[model samples]
Target: MAVMDDSRLAEELRLTIGRLVRTVRAVDTMPPGEAAVLGYLDRGGPLTTAEIAQQRGVSHQSAAKTVKGLLTQGLVRVEAHPDDGRKLLLTLTPAGHDRLAEERRRRADRLGRAINAVLTPDERKTLEAALPLLSRLSTHGTGE
Candidate 1:
């Protein structure tokens, strides 16, 4: 059999993943950046504005703006950092936790429904089996 064109395969995978992400994100209450910052905090624990910005691959000002929105929504709050009164820490408020949880549920449900409705049982199984390969592909260039 002829070898598959790596470029074509890469392009197809990139577009497919992008569309899938966009579709899931469309149902989310929070915008992508805000949701991402919230997610990083939720999983990685509280952090400073600069830390959040670094982890999210955005500028300090951009992260601050997103944080400000979260604050306005009462989703996150700033408090004095322990062991360092000079610095402030950002953490999710009770409302923030609730909002993130709901957003995640909605996105997962939307994607799950689409997969179940669109893919046959065998196809779903095939996709499930490809998870490891897909994950490897996703992290291929990363030093993780």
Candidate 2:
């Protein structure tokens, strides 16, 4: 029997995980794009639509659409940038923060249950130990 290459196995695992993530539901009234924008705001504080687009790797027009949707939903508000009167800065409302927190909690619970189901105690320990390396891989573009 031949062993599979590590890189091939990792690619398969990443694809499977991505598919699974796409299926999970977020507990927000907003659409996925709006929710993603809110999540980014929750993490990064106030930012302009262009900045959000850059961070999300999307076109400014797409980000503007998302911002408009979020503004309509009352999940975010726009204010004149103090330093730049021509630009607007977007920030989450209190309701948006609450919604984001709830969504995060729901996702965490779902992930915890799934992790508990498939992983043995020792495997769980190993995963916990490997989390930092995995996080680095995720953040540093090494995993892809």
Candidate 3:
């Protein structure tokens, strides 16, 4: 096979990945902002609203709006910060864990079905083989 241009490959890969994300997100049961907050809290709980805003790359008010909805839905709870009384720490509740798990399972099941329907066994293997490389590449994603 002929060698592909690196720049062209990068552009194509970026666009394709963006499209894939959009397609998968179509199955989301909740707004992406709320789901993202739930995911971050699950992975790193007891974070402050400021931290959530940083992680989300959104303004504090934007993160607050999402957190407010989660609070009303009983998916998250806020507690006074141990180190700083002025700020509140956010953590997922039991219901929040259940909801996040259900959401993940639903998305995974949909993706799994699509994969089974669309890809041949060898193609599936090839995609699986790319996962580690993709993961490694993503480690550079947060570089400033």
Which candidate has the highest TM-score of all?
3
Please provide TM-scores, in order, for all candidate models, with all chains considered together: 0.89, 0.84, 0.94
Comparing 1 and 2 on lDDT, the stronger one: 1
Give the TM-score comparing model 2 with the true structure, all chains together.
0.84
Tell me how far the alpha carbon of residue 117 in candidate 2 is from the true structure, in angstroms, after superposition: 2.4
Cα lDDT, all candidates: 0.91, 0.85, 0.93
Best candidate, lDDT = 3
Encode model 1's per-residue lDDT on 2-99: one tens digit a residue. Answer: 76599988888889899999898889876889998889889988899999999989999999999999989999999999988988999999998999
Superposing all C-alpha atoms, what RMSD in Å does each candidate have to the true structure? Answer: 1.8, 2.9, 1.6
**Candidate 2 lDDT, 1-144, residue by residue in tens:** 787699987998799768768645633344778778988898888999999999889999999998988888788999999999999999999988987888878877877887899899999999899889878767895343
- Which runs in model 1 stand beyond 4 Å of their true positions? 1-3, 141-143
Model 3: per-residue Cα lDDT over 1-144, one tens digit each: 877799988898999999888878888889999999999999987899899999999999999999999999999999999999898999999999999999999888888998999999999999999999888888876662
Off by over 4 Å in 2: 1-6, 23-29, 141-144
